[model samples]
Target: MSHSLSRLPTLATAAVAAAIAAAEPAAASRAVQSRTVKINGVELFYREAGPSNAPTVLLLHGFPSSSHMFRNLIPQLSERYHVIAPDYPGFGYTVAPADFSYTFASIADLIDAFTQTIGVRQYTLFVQDYGGPVGFRLAVKHPERLQGLVIQNAVANVEGWSPDAVKQLAPFWKERNTETEKPIRALLTADTTRFQYEHGTTRPQNLSPDAWTMDQAGLDRPGNDAIQLDYFFDYQNNVAAYPAWGEFLKQKQPPTLIVWGRNDPFFTLKGVEYFRNLLPNATVHDYDAGHFALETYGDEIAAETLRFLDTLPDK
Candidate 1:
């Protein structure tokens, strides 16, 4: 399922309007370059930084956002860890066939294909938002491909959501109704993006305008709104896959770090507890931040992540 951008509300606010105007001139000045990779017939657009042979870190974004979400965090990490962030099919610069079935499992296959195509045999995985399901699917299929795991504001359990979001989706869980449910599915916009950052973070106003603008433009792209809505609907089944995901962790035991936004709106702090219990060797950090901790506390979180990596005796 795909949606046209016409359904998304246009940002006419003075602040947002001004940011877009300012970004236009400098957009060409930005140094990051993007490339297209074909996998299973889907064309994926991805941004790359750092040396190819450097320690690899694959970053995955969630719904209503893209690799664009990592605009700020990527450069910082690239200095140390070779970074690759791709816009999922139907999101960012990637384009999904109008008839494609946008399931989490399918996305995992694409991730695996992209990595192999790029000659990455092993690398760390960083997951956020929908990245939980998508990245986890990759983990389940190719646990050996993962070097380590870092999660920010991703749900490892169904128990991590706020009561409001759970309740809102409860009805659609029982029945399949896109027309009656589309509006609610389309609810995550700049307003909700702001809400997600503020409510999910310990500090909200620290967000950057460039980061916000990239998110807005990617979601505003034509035909993206529907894909987002479809993914929201697909998330209902994500819970069913959790038990197997947990089982995979128990069997594989990938060294894990939990960088959680203490105030995440969708996934509560309980997710930290869940990962801690599930992975005996996992280390956890709760930041006074929201869903996008990197946006609010990137430097601190990145430092913490590097510190954690350093503690690995073999690294």
Candidate 2:
């Protein structure tokens, strides 16, 4: 009888361990997946998390950044929201064909195809820097596909752009000459990339060097500079689109949330006013950090994003 009892204890322990092991994979499945899919012959890289059935949140990164910017914010949202961040043709790990057009319109077209390929019929868009141009283009092309909009340091109104950016870009926007384009090249340096991530945040210490490390690595790749320049020249199209996007916002008024870094050097705080005026009902959350507000204020931003998301009328 004692022998049998001893065996029972060992068996109970084994059963308990097996149960624990089983639960681990479930949690592990929640981890973000780095994946790639071909769209128009380009290999697009993305990070996805949360259940396939959950409402989708499409994250669009800014200049010199990629889906990696959302690394901290993704897990925070993955439990309740399906989050996906893709590296545009000229950015991050995505591989573009030599013959692919590098204009913002073409990039948006591929992303549109990407959504169709992934079977995501609708989603909320989270846009930053370059994302502003890309996301706004997507929104204009197919306004029906937008479930909501989450704007982080992206502007639809040209008046919202910083004067320096507007001034520096004017020549390039007018004509891509050596004199005009030469100045723009300075913005592509590692120093500028690091500056964008570190300049405005309060917690400079915690911000990972890896953010710029990875972004600069991607930038350093052959022919990538020209890809970025094409986008820079193409940015004029996004500027011309301000009126249409503004009108769309006024008409659709999709549930809007604006999270900004007030201290940003590239994009001025004045830009926030344009959104406020257009989206009087839009919620705005401003942080003292720089361009990459999420780097230091992620917990706060994540909470605001969740609060904003829950209040949405539907998926």
Against the true structure, whose lDDT is highest? 2
Q: Clash pairs of candidate 1?
A: 3-226, 200-290, 201-289, 201-290, 202-289
Error of 1 at 308 (Å): 2.9
> Which stretches of model 1 miss by more than 4 angstroms?
1-31, 178-183, 200-202, 311-315
TM-score of each: 0.84, 0.93
lDDT of 2 by residue, 68-155 (tens): 9999999988878888999998888899678899888888898889998999999999998888878888887888889889999988
Clashing pairs in 2: 200-290
Going through the candidates in the order shown, the clash numbers are 5, 1
* Per-residue lDDT of model 1, residues 238-283, tens digit only: 8888899988888888888888888877789778778888887898
Query: Residue 107 CA error for candidate 1 (Å)?
Result: 1.3
| The 10-residue segment with the lowest total lDDT in model 2 | 22-31
State the RMSD for candidate 1. Answer: 14.4
The C-alpha local distance difference test score for the whole of candidate 2 amounts to: 0.88
lDDT of each: 0.78, 0.88
